[model samples]
Target: MSDRNGNPQDPDNGPESPHRLIEARLQKMAELGESVELYPYGFDRSHTSEQMRADEKSLTEAETKVRYPGRIMAKRGTGKTLFVPVQDERGTVQAYFRKDDLGDEAFHRVQKLMDIGDWVGVEGKLFRTRTGELSIHVEDFTFLSKAIRPLPEKYHDMSLENRCRRRYLDLAMNQESRERFRRRSEIIAEIRAFFAEEEFLEVETPVLQSLYGGATARPFKTHHNALDMTLYLRIADELYLKRLIVGGLEKVYEIAKDFRNEGMDRTHNPEFTMLECYAAYWDYHDMMDLMERLMRRLARGISADGKLKYGEVELDFSQPFGRIRFMDALQDKTGRDLMAADDEEVAAVAREHGITLKKGMGRDKILDELFSELVEPGLVQPTFVMDHPKELSPLAKAHRETEGLVERFEMFVAGFELSNSFSELNDPREQRERFVAQKALLEAGDEEAQQLDEDFLQAMEQGMPPTGGMGIGIDRLVMLLVDSNNIRDVLLFPHMRPEQS
Candidate 1:
């Protein structure tokens, strides 16, 4: 069988194949009138070697007489006897083959037809090798599928750039990637259970909204052929979850896909999952308490002591998270009081910090850029950076004492923003004014600005109760739980540019 690039005889290049050779080989087999194998074939044993390793007791020969199915990863030796490494979803196990046992015709067929990467089901007796390595002694085997291309050799050192580019092969060879995803599934289950225990009803919302009003990010737009109208993929589920609150649902949440038309990075993706929930009659502080508790619970599920080793530091999620005001962080880091700084004074501060500001740029934009550059990276531990500038937060309630600030708190962990919470503004008049301000920003050429959602305003006009709401970055959380350094590692199928044909 040939590899993707047509040189099937070449083993070193097999792992990087795009299945071109494999597909071509299958077509050739069809022309040769060779029938493909079927699955759900009878098997006495289904336990994989990896599963067996995790089991409490040892498996006996009588138990090993069962059948196991998996893909053949490697083959060694030749002629009468051979050793093969077979991998299933759970793990890999060694299989021993003898020429005498199969007889001459069967042995010839095995030598000619069987190739690495082929899916095979084997019925075997269980035994330990002379070296005490657990193995399956094959009595009969069936071709589950023929694989033309060989897999990459794991012994050689290759660049990670190549591994990421050909992730399917990487997944085939790497155990760590598989384990991380297993942990990711566990993390999601634990969080889902936590929300269910809290009596929060998980709900779904429209992904395509008429007006993409939620967070301050650019949105991917699409056109419907039937109606010939523009629609946008949601940037956040914030507005929909809050609408559920207005519908008299006390607590509502949604963990679903959100699309943002933004730049890709190690920490950013054009499309990602956003977990948003809202509870009536609760404030930002209450949300903070619940948020931290939930995080600690998730951490406990992922780690032995409710703590994780990130880099050289151990981040303990067991204790109460610290709270600091936005202005306080700015003053501490930059030695300038953001509350007292006027336009001219803030402009000078920005200039000193090498920040350029446009004409008519407000205090909020200046302060935000400054904080993101200086203050955000240093917040390694879990911290609630609260009371943000009013211009930056249109949906949050006004700060109790600060005139131009809002009651919002963003939780940062491991130098990444994990969650954003706020006491939602419910007054119809105030909501209308906020939307107008956002509309003005959009008109002024801020494409990232939010559009005015009249329908959402009408929902508020129905006298919606004051509420607490939050948006958590599920990918970032999974990254922390799985100890994954890059965002792409946690994602099953990360976005990638199409390789040149």
Candidate 2:
């Protein structure tokens, strides 16, 4: 058949064939309604496929009737009996349908109208097939929902781009993908449970704010119609969560959606989930212990021996994660003391490393570029790179022993910085100075620099106790736990470019 443009649009052979298949399914739907009560949708399910399988050994054929709802995954047999595989959220089970049991009319209707990808309510009893596979013997059935379009062929091995673009189809057709998301949920639940057990209250903060600070990231701006003011999607919940600490809600955490108007990559998503937690009386040292415990807990939840394998690397979370001072590691890697280097020296070092220097780049930015390019990628094991230069950690408390350094650490694993923690700077005067410095960076063309939030400063002036704050990239953590190489793998719907029409 030809398309609207009169081109040779092979409806049977070309890209438009899927539309033809949809039309065929729609026609079947219309025909099926002629004889039977189509009851195209229902949710009265007695047992999921997994539950039925678990209870299969105890269930006797024709004695324990079961009502299950699932999508038809595959079909076989052509004569009086048919074996179809049906998949629910939990798992898949083979269902045996006999013409004698279902009645000739219903069997004929199913034979003519039922298609793979259609949702069906199956009333059956547990039975073992001739091949000894556990299955359901169909007594009666109902067509739950019609799937007009066919699922992708070999969906489990489909290209990443297509899989992400049609995530619902991916979830429907790919059991591994569904299980990965299920594990993601389990991990998040465990994390919440861990925090709650530690007496930390799970709290929520604003996603939209009049002013954005807390993290060094570009903000996504929006306008509040009622207030007639510009609002920004929060890049981090750090400042606000700390304000709660000041208000005597000492132990608090938030698992929230943080937006950064930034580039996307294997580890970075523009919109991502972050777990930001704060403890009023704690410091960075305490945070390090908490982080280690948390990682071990997550690792144990996934693997019994507190070990997790990401790609080819097996990480031992039970072992104490290694720690090296940030400047020491930078110098060890680059043979240059970044803390002692002036801007000219840092710029020269950056040039030596073949790093691109942005216009108006300061010493800290130069040092950061050098570390990311030369040092970060080699951090394969679980390690804490600690004691950052003050210039790189404005929100962190200055190190008591080190003159120009702050008590901050970034936990790195498999070359990805999973979490950042700081012995938070609670001195209002010092915080104002840091904000002023950040403002200077903002003026000097650093769009990702932290903003000077006067309100947060005022809250600080109201006397917040010494606190430790940590922010974890939950997406990156999930990627590590699930052995997913890309951040997009964990995210249900990551940001993507506009599809060509």
Candidate 3:
């Protein structure tokens, strides 16, 4: 979030100056040391602002005493009394403090040094003000903590960069930021609940791997000091989860952090969360069905009616998701069957479409490019872009009906690839052949090509069953549910460029 309102200010400040404001607060803290502990160890409290608000009716009727601790967000009036809004995590409560209630020294101490953003514990009886608003008539108060610098004046007006960078300020000042992240947590929980209902066991996988070979993405490389061998941060959890399926864990899912050494954008992040699952005896069709059901569950969990408006587009989860074959969609867009075309023909289509082909860029990659460039953007509604070419999905089983295609489908929503699934290839010999093809691509200078993992091949050779695997970009899913525009908005602390000193 950008600080569009310029800099925050202190109560007595004229124009903004950070050094002056901080130094002034520091001096005040030193003075307050004589009357109270500026950095006190703790403040005993009976209720949060939310709890206080909830019990207000009974408490006010009984004239009950309550202790509440929270950060001061707003301060009003002067002279012998003041009304301040003390905010805790859930909400805020109005606190009324007067010289008559606390006597001369305590009230004088508060008036002299207490500032907005300071945390205080107050003992008070609940009552309504002249305007009939619920308020705490303070009997006593204690200083808990002090904020040396003022908070941003207009937090919502902050730029995206600033809000993400200074998430602490954003959470403190803006209710929307707090609620958005809380919604992210709820969405994740709902996903887990949906899988649990389907009896998929939640599992853990390694973050670092001996060899990475799930998705077509470069990995963040690292060295193991003890073993003294090169290890790569996992780019996806597909391989390990598949191994679990081979070991007879028929249904499994992992919500994992994956590192991909790639470009960063609104949809892409170097480090992101992924939900990868594999099921034995299941095919891509079963996985697609599961995705649709899960989407409906997640939509209702985040919003009522299972419907949402993201920017100008309204996404309705109440209806069935649309379906289109990968090749069919591409052919419709370009008025030609580029899928049946030869390697050179595909390359020509790519160039004609203004997609830059790298050194090892093959026909499958070119086809994917064409789809992404031409057909993907129009997938505003939920859709399954199904039956991709065999070369494009090295780990997917060959399609039962189609000659050159694999049983693969990509779920696209709001023009973004939400998930990818495949009827996983189980024949060890065919798997080896696919690995060889990928190896050839790797040798031809494709940094994003999947490497042949001998151990993974060995597992497949050990009579692995026909399995279905799917991976959901959890961050992207959260973005759609929460209506977040950037991937960074969902991530607590997304990867960023180092500050230039």
Candidate 4:
């Protein structure tokens, strides 16, 4: 077989020959007793490479003994001494392996057994190299695990499709990918801490449901053979979490994995993380405050002055985010008052703006299409677009002052919707009416319409609090904080198409 460039495709004969390397590693393993037990489950790593570097001066003076386990990143200086770079999760440290220091048997073992990408634990004394680089001078070493396949030469610069498909290699070879995931964890931890500090109870909601109702998105469906019933992977956790609120768990939040049978894009994924929080007795206005504080806290956790760069723009999270009424923003951008316009007028405007209108799209859908095309791109700075039309928000409460708008807001930054908040509609009758309207749209070929879940309405009838609810796209939030352009850059294992044979 040949590659696209007409190069030989056989792994055993190709450059950096993965098949040949794997065979050699297997042989080496056989020589060293070769079972799963050869690779021990745990190693006592006294300090991380990062910690050793931080305490370099003190440790070097004290001649402190340390045990560190890491993947061998690079090896140099073959004969008398070996200078190897070993990387753990935190950072990388250079290891100096001298024949005189390790004596003959151990030095020969290190040379014969170790390879780049192999996992090893080294017992060493902390010191600094002549060039002032923090290093560990090894006294002895233990082989932990072996890597059979060769890593890509320029893995960091590999194509995005390959990076997403082989994320383990991407994480191993690219430091940026490793650090981005690290920051993702830290960001989520800070978010949980912020909610906990605010007296919110962290809760879990079911990922599989008998009926899906919460967001307007197509759901991934499955069947349970035992129950002999069809089920849908949750498109959102809003309905279930609100049920918890009805069951008297006030101020509840869930960080959940939401699945949508949707198209993939820079921002959209089939499976994604969502942070949904509902606070009792609060309104959309209060949600706005909470969203701002949460974003600011995340910025402060990752940056110094509550400011961070997303692509070319420097987002300032310290100051209050800007706000624009949804209809006003639409009017300002497209020079059309969509709220006041009839369906035909809105359709005309959409056509004039070169926005493609799907079949059976209503006035609200047309207006939203226009807003996404014209208004959303200009909202680079943190801005809240509030008071959406009633048709655009089925679950949100009707606006207190506006005639035909709902108390709903979507936070946008860098041309992407980061968070959505609603003054939840607790009236069972009103919610039922909204669901009926949604059912009409669904029957009219809109697959992304919310389904009427009777149980949820029963819960509402039993009485749900006047709640303020918010759903933040956690992946997008991580992207903004980490300056990642693609959502997959932040997601550890984003969905990808199957490889063609």
Over 135-173, each residue of candidate 1 has an lDDT whose tens digit, in order, gives: 677788776766666577769744565566667777777
Q: Write the per-residue lDDT of candidate 3 for residues 18-83, one digit (tens) a residue.
A: 557677787888888887888889978888877877888888788889899988897786789989
Report the backbone clash tally of model 4: 0
TM-score for each candidate, following the candidate numbering:
0.91, 0.93, 0.93, 0.93
Candidate 2 TM-score over all chains jointly? 0.93
Supply candidate 2's per-residue lDDT for 424.
Answer: 97
- Collision count of model 3: 6
lDDT of 1 at 51: 69
What candidate 2 gets wrong by more than 4 Å, as runs, is 1-18, 39-43, 336-343
**Over the full model, what C-alpha lDDT does candidate 2 score relative to the true structure?**
0.86
lDDT at 108, model 4: 65
- For candidate 4, the TM-score is 0.93
Residue by residue across 44-78, what tens digits does model 2's lDDT show?
Answer: 78888778777776766336888888889888976
lDDT of 3: 0.87
The CA lDDT of each predicted structure is 0.81, 0.86, 0.87, 0.87
Worst lDDT run of 10 residues, candidate 4, spans: 1-10
